[model samples]
Target: MKYKKTILATTILSALLILIALGVSLVVSPMVERKAEQLLTRYAARVGAIERCSFSRVEFSPLSRSLTLHDVLVIYRSPKGLRKSMDRLEISVPLRAAACAVPSLRPYVLPENGSMDVCNSITADGVSFSMPGLLAGSLKHAAISGVSADARHVRAILDGRRPEPVDLLEHAVIDGLDAVNLRATVQTGTGSAACTLGAFRLRGLHDLGIEEIRFEQLNAATNKERAGIALFGMDGFRAPDAATLRLLLSVRLDGKKSPQALDKDIEHVLPMLQQWLTATIPPVRVLAVEKASFRGSRPQDVMSLDLMRLDWLSNRPREMKTAVKDLVLPAQLVESNGLHLPGLKELRFNGESDTRDEDGRIRETGYLSLARFGQLRYNASYAVPGGVFNFSLMQLLSMTIHDAAFSFVDQGALAYIALNQHDPDMAGPYFNQALDYSFPGRDNDALRAALKVFTDRPGTLDIVKTTSEPTPLLRCFDVATLGRLWRVSATPGKESLYDQMRRLAPAR
Candidate 1:
């Protein structure tokens, strides 16, 4: 009897222990799942922010330790105040491995079923983003099945597939992995663009290691339009490693036109453009055309041009212009290195008088080629009251003169007079008058004496007598002009001639 009782007690204790262990496993599993869900949610938020997107809803499953997110939306705003939205995004993630590995801490899991709406805001037909293996650290591989968006000013269809894997933590020395396959069509009003990927894979969390990631047959539409700019075809884009990113893009205008015709158009409009540009960026001194070409229709005035290759180093605007005027240089000029002009070579101008408005302003367009010495070859066209004028200068003197005038205007009479003498056209009358008042009663004899000492010319007296104008004894002289003349006469031996002229002139 005692033996039988002991056996029963042992059996009961074993059953109780087994039941307790089972309960613990059940409780721990659910807790782990909840932790994973929380971590994933946080990660999703971070990713969305970086991508400029948001998710409408997130669903979590405790039993499988998985998360399903849906209705991801991305938005963009155009310069014209138009808002665009991409919607209907869905993603799923498995947290089983992450949950089991870190029971006490939460694990991060990326979503699957990478799909989204494309260009929902601009076009009548909705676009899509389909990827088979889009999520990093997911259980299955994904690929983008289809993608569509507003192309040109209209909508078109796109079809292609690309698979890529990315490692997020390789550089950080963390154990992580990522892979993505994106295939889609970019739709436009007239045509389509396609992209295909071989593989994009990454491993090692902190120090990212990539394995054979490539983009193939990545092409855009043959034609498209947005705002006033035209887009040709996209050649291909590639990022071999973390250090470099490269892309090849080509584009043309909406219509067809000859390159020579385009060149002529740009030549006509460059001067006014230069003036306008100077008003904005003052450091630019010289704007020369490099090369120009054009394509498109004439009636609608639709065309495409390239000025990016022009030399722009000496083309900075003057400070005076900046303070007094609101000016706009071409986008190409602004983007170039204003301090270093190497590609510009020439500038050309052409235009039609008939096209000029009553105010003498004509519309024009053309191309520019920046060849060498930071020079630009431009083809321009426009209308002006006096007709179109296109000319190039080895140096831009007007800009220099303008700069000097503004810089010296704040100084006293002597400085102002000196500046005016260099360029009388730009000086104010007040400056001229001030100089006259300061030199009152100064006879030509004293002027001759001063000039004799500073100049080297032997026949200074003869030149002075010939150049001076008859005036009343108290009449004011143009100090600015006198100063400039003195400089010219004072060259080496000409100093004496300058002195003689000063003496022959009437006193102020």
Candidate 2:
């Protein structure tokens, strides 16, 4: 009888312990998740908005010193009416200071843990972007595996629909640099009916201190106007001081917009775009397109002339690129700032240029062979006391056999404008249109006069012929007789632009 009673009592005690443990867990789970929601929502508030910061469950293992949040959901409202979502976030924060956060200039309240870094590992089962359409686009199995201050492994499988017919995330990797491949099947979206790229891969490096970023792209596009780019690659870097970039893209556009339309906007939008570039201070480097079968305006026209209002590159300008008859290739931008325009040190694309290469032929096939290759080089200097600005432009034509043809000159232009307070942000140290031809025979008449007016001090130029100049290639138009020919070529339009031109002319 005594043994049986003892056994019964022990059984009752064990049952009681089990019930108590279950009750504690049931209560603590809510408390833990609630606290997590508060903390996460707080963070989102500091950074941006989170429509709802919640998780299906939260588990804390005291012995393991770990916190796991299950079925987490995060929603963000971008300014342009876009909603970004991250769902099924399984973040395991090992309470033992698993990793230290990289200190940021942005004010962030750190946890009691000594380090100022984010939690150790952040994993999300799915993340997506959506328009009002209810289903936008997403990535599956996105994660930051070995996250730390210096480096982390980021991987994501892209399988999502853009607001378009069917957009796709081809692939993505976020490591020292973040790379993403996006495929869009849309006629147009977001920006004022911009042309959308069929697919593109974007790689970016971020500035730890600010919202600065450097980007590169491997892109392909198909536009509504029956225009396309087979392959386009661009790479650029931006820092506080200066920037450099290159372009080697192949493009096809349609009937270009008349030059009158382009000429009007070029003056305003041209510098506006360059200003847009300079707005990002420190240093900037970019690589642009090289070849094209353009039916209409060049990409520079859309960037510098048409789409001047929106954010640069960020608004997905590549998608906005369309073949339209709005602007010209090698259009001229009169330097607004006579000598003080000092910022644009070097800017050249698809123009005569000089660069060192043994064969001059580009190894890449199916690209524009302007020569062995095209060359553009520029350098400028300023003297505070002498008030003089020296600038140089050099070009090399691929039309010449091997290394036989080249045209280069260095000229020192004196700053005509006083250190005046009101100087329209200048294009600086450059005649925007180098007046050289892609197929040789570019007129240097007006360009020479403009050079004389703004860039040349008359006696300061040192014209040197490094290689044989093809006679027809560097031909100068007889500006002295252009007025007589203008009667035929410069017919007045509905706005009577020819009349306006005569109005601005001297009383000859």
Candidate 3:
């Protein structure tokens, strides 16, 4: 009987202790919530210079060291006023400080006693920002993971609807943000379009592996015009200088100006652009694109490009190369302009230029080749006394031409052009007669021979300037005639462009 009584008494005492614990929880939770709210209000008031901030509710968990806010809003009034709001914001701070204390020494020592995660997570849901004449952006959800100061992981889904139908990112994951891929939808006046940014890696301000940037209309039937970049990439990217960045940002962010005033505003910025070009500009190693295309509703509106590339191989002596291949233009469009030549497939261009200081003169040498149904190659060199070039017309005219040569290879285009003329059968003889009558000199005879050879049987013909003296560009065009200055010489070329470039840039 005594043991049973003792057990009952002990049970009553346990029930009383449970009641006390419940009372403490109810009282402490409200107090913690109020304190969190007060702290947030104080912070907002203290740093409310650029923006006014407020929240409707605050929830805090002391054990987990996590805090959540509901109905957070911020209003900014710079250049033009804008508003931002979020449905909920949650931040989970680490329960222990050891993990974040020495973030740089990661993957070695972890938080003691497994007290906290390696990263503190902060999340925002239903975030939206809007400004007139600019953009309206929203985030369905976004999260930052890893150390709070330096996040190692981030993920988000962002959408934009102003300026264009820009659905910025359907989903994105930035693992240390080393590499990222983004896809978006762009709304056009005619129809909707989709854009994709291929995988790219980032280190500090440098970027690499920018595999592609593509755009294409979603519904071609409903669109009046369609355009796309099938592939695009660049290497050796350096971020612009701080001042340039600030200038660019100010122009975009200062939204006080109206659309009508934009052109004038840009005009005022051109002088500053000159400084931008010469200051803190680093060369991009390589930029390439494959298969950029465009099409309009009309059949004559089609255009396609197979490849385009630019290389800044060297900056010391300023060596550069550029190429354009298989650029197609609609034959119908050409015919509409009253040209009779048909069956033209594509146009191509390859060029290389080098500038260097030799002795006391600045020498520039380059070769340009253009090909459509036929091919034409021009190689030239110019020299000028070592001095700053002010880019004036007089300065350009004063430069001396050291050497120049032009070459042509027939690929059936000459025959088509001759056949389309009146009196096709006698076209060759007539052209020869005209050449003789128009030019009468020793150099003229050489040109005549080259032309006759080409007419007899379509073949390669070369013309080179014999002038060894430095001739000013103005005198070359105005005083000296081409027939008197240049001579025809036979130099055959059958090498493909790929082989030609390989020879030109042996280091590559």
Candidate 4:
């Protein structure tokens, strides 16, 4: 009888306990829901939106004292005239945090001990984005993996109806203390327009610091009529092995715009662009080093001239074909800068056109060859009506040597100009000044003397005798010119000519 009574009492106690637990759950369930709603409202207030949110189910566990949520979405609209459409986003966070900050659920708080996952898909008129996995944890850090976007038929309305398309792929891994390391690639193309930026890496995201970044390849191709300017191929730009103190930019213009028209626009808008870019883009200020190298390969017969290399360090780098026709500029003064260069160190040109031979026979054969380095530093400034002006300076110092304290004091001052007034004939005087400076005469002895500093071993320049009719490869300033000026001989025992040339070249 005693055993029976004890068993019966135990059964009753167990049933009562079960009922009590069920009652507590019933009461807490509504509280949890209310808490979630309140939390969402608070978040909406902070972000300044309420109608842009929707939520699914929220569940709590008593055993672990944790909360889990599903299907949380947030949508936003971008400002007018932007490229994108609606910015649709979705994220899932731990219910604990979501509940603790609720305004309606008074004195009820959930502990923070869980993780969150976010996935978003945004689509604009021409742009589309999808991120597969974005995760955050209390103990661990946040990360985004397998993120991709497709941007086709996109247009930047700010600069007229410019057609733009962009495709991006990115992935990132972060640590507990908010250290992020990421890699991404972006490619854009529209019509004949194309651009690619590959092999990008970023570290220390909060402050926008890049430990190492490389542009493995960059290329653009566009028809002349569409591009608005002469097209140049900027093949591959590599940074020095060490970290750079300054910023470098490689921009490509590939659209249906004439080079002259583009130049005019650029001339008018470059300052504004510079100001906006410097102010809006955080990365620009951190970059202290800058270098731009270019290459171009045009179809034969398109023009009368041949392609040439642009050697930044040469005394007279090869000249690029400008749209200006019949300008009557000196051959030596090919560029805006007063200094005549030897030629570009690297270049390749091929094509043929009628020279109007006396017999007037058409010739189809053409030849191509590499170009040599020429001019070093070139600078020129021109102004148009309405206070519009354009000026540029090319520094020939090598990236390696320039970073080692090449002085820009002289050139820097020249680059600074305040064109508050209009001057249309500025190009003429600048052109004339370049011609006068580049004339081959004793008048430029100071420049010649300065150039001599670049040649350490000036005597090695050998003038080999030609047995056959020597074909003119291309017109370039040779070390022989420097040697002649130094009155040095090509004798076998003479000081190393290369060393002398280096000595004659000006130090940065």
RMSD of 1: 23.2
Q: How far is candidate 3 from the true structure (C-alpha RMSD, Å)?
A: 13.4
1-508 in candidate 3: lDDT tens per residue?
9999999999999999878877876776678678768756765565434367888888866556577899999877664567788899987766443223334543444422312243466777777776664445555665655432112221110111121111111112222222223334445555555444443333222121122222222122224666667666665544344444445455753677887676665665554554433233334556787877888888667788778887755433434567777777776665667755545543444555555445434555555554544677776766644343333466677788877777777655555555456344466577778767766666467666766666656668787778867787776654226667677765433542223323333333
Local lDDT at 404 for model 2: 27
Per-structure clash totals for the candidates: 102, 44, 1, 74
Mind giving the per-residue lDDT tens digits that candidate 2 earns over 409-442?
Answer: 2121122221122222232223224322221233
User: Native-vs-model 1 lDDT?
Assistant: 0.30
Candidate 2 vs candidate 3: the TM-score winner is 3
Error of 3 at 359 (Å): 5.9
Best by TM-score: 3
Worst 10 residues of 4 by lDDT: 398-407
lDDT of 1 by residue, 301-404 (tens): 22233322222222211011111011122323422544221222222222111111223322222222121111112221223222322233422211111000
Runs off by more than 4 Å, candidate 2: 1-35, 41-48, 58-81, 90-125, 133-135, 140-223, 226-236, 241-508
Position 263, candidate 1: lDDT: 55
Q: Model-by-model lDDT, in order? A: 0.30, 0.33, 0.56, 0.30
Query: How do these models rank on lDDT, best leading?
Result: 3, 2, 1, 4
RMSD of model 2 against the true structure: 20.0
| Candidate 4: regions farther than 4 A off | 1-42, 45-78, 81-200, 206-459, 462-508
Model 3 pairs whose backbones collide? 165-187
Cα deviation of 74 in candidate 4 (Å)?
A: 5.3
